[model samples]
Target: MDSRNLIRHKTQVVCIGAGPAGLTASYKLCQNQIPVVILETNPIYVGGISRTVNYKGYLFDIGGHRFFSKSQAVEDFWTEILGDEMLTRPRKSRIFYKNKFFDYPLKAMQALLNLGILESILCVASYIESKLFPPKEIRSFEDWVCKNFGKRLYSIFFKTYTEKVWGMSCDEISADWASQRIKGLSLSKAIINSLISPNANQDRAKVTKSLINSFRYPRKGPGQMWEVTAERIKEMGGKLFMGTHVC
Candidate 1:
């Protein structure tokens, strides 16, 4: 292990983001004896959009991001990196509908009951109308959603928030988003399932269960995890370049 030979044979791996993906890659590479250089634009932080920020001594995230992967390898990797800092948290989500807060993955009976007789009747009517005269091509997201779940349900559950997120009207957006986001979901099925078997293996129900439940969070937030990983990488003869941007 001569110094000259070490300098000559040094392996270099440059990772750009220093986010979860980049940090994980760097960690694995270092584990295999490969030298890594992480370049990040933000000088004060390494985590990307998933980064956590402290405001008035309170840690706040860019959004509600949780670490929950279906892959065991990913889970194991995080557990190894985070150790006891990883905490399992119960999920709490709600939907604001007609100035009322309702549990997300909307309880069908409760939702309909809350909508009242007139609105519920309109929802039923819209569903019946769509069923009788189904759209010819299902061109837009609005059309697809209305056809499947009806106008009232779509307006209540999908319209405003979706518009806010995508910055587009339901008609302007592609059906692909709706199809992928709410695949195999329908108001008729939801109501019937609620009445008959609420716990049936419906695709939407499964997706909802997978989403709103429990998730892992680092003790100080996601930034702490990346900071520790970065430290480990540096300790393993890696170089981290902060405030470096690459176009």
Candidate 2:
């Protein structure tokens, strides 16, 4: 290709990624009559962590994407993309401990049934002890979790999973990572939330993404939403350059 023919075109907004963040921004820009260009490092696909992968006509989520957010506009934007193709799904997950299964989001009654009276009593005592005397120096993930949920619960629920994911002892991992990734709810908050009905505020701003029970998902896969979003952007006079890798 001649350098002269490869003259760079000008754009008002240059989106560096074609993932959810970049694509969403571009869609809004195009909606408001602004010109934009998208640059994605991946040769194909769009949703980023929320993207779905296809194998021989079978689609699978690369990372589970529960399209839940505190922002009504964000939720609306997702609905605008998929419309009826979106499905609101109830969450169902479980915790495995000592050959026992406990429902997640933890119904207190279920936990009591699963953990038994003696174990439950010990867990409560541990929680009270942690509350009364938090570890003096809170540095590691273990320290943080034990201080909040208690040593017993941490050992059963957190320690194993944390080690498995990071392949490091909890004492080695920093507490800051917990603050950044696991915000909104704590062990105390989870217990309280389970005991009561959702607050009647009805404000989307108050909703926490992590604790929400229901979320929207594309009927086919998350990739379908992005595919349609890209098409709409093109129809609105936005340029989509596929198979183009940029640093």
The clash count of every prediction, one per candidate, is 0, 0
For each candidate in turn, the TM-score is 0.74, 0.73
lDDT (tens digit, per residue) of candidate 1 on 59-169 = 887656678775789889889888999999987767887788766556667777888999888888988888888888888899888888777778887788778756789
In candidate 2, residue 8 scores what lDDT? 23
Candidate 2 lands at a TM-score of: 0.73
What is the model-wide C-alpha lDDT for candidate 2?
A: 0.75
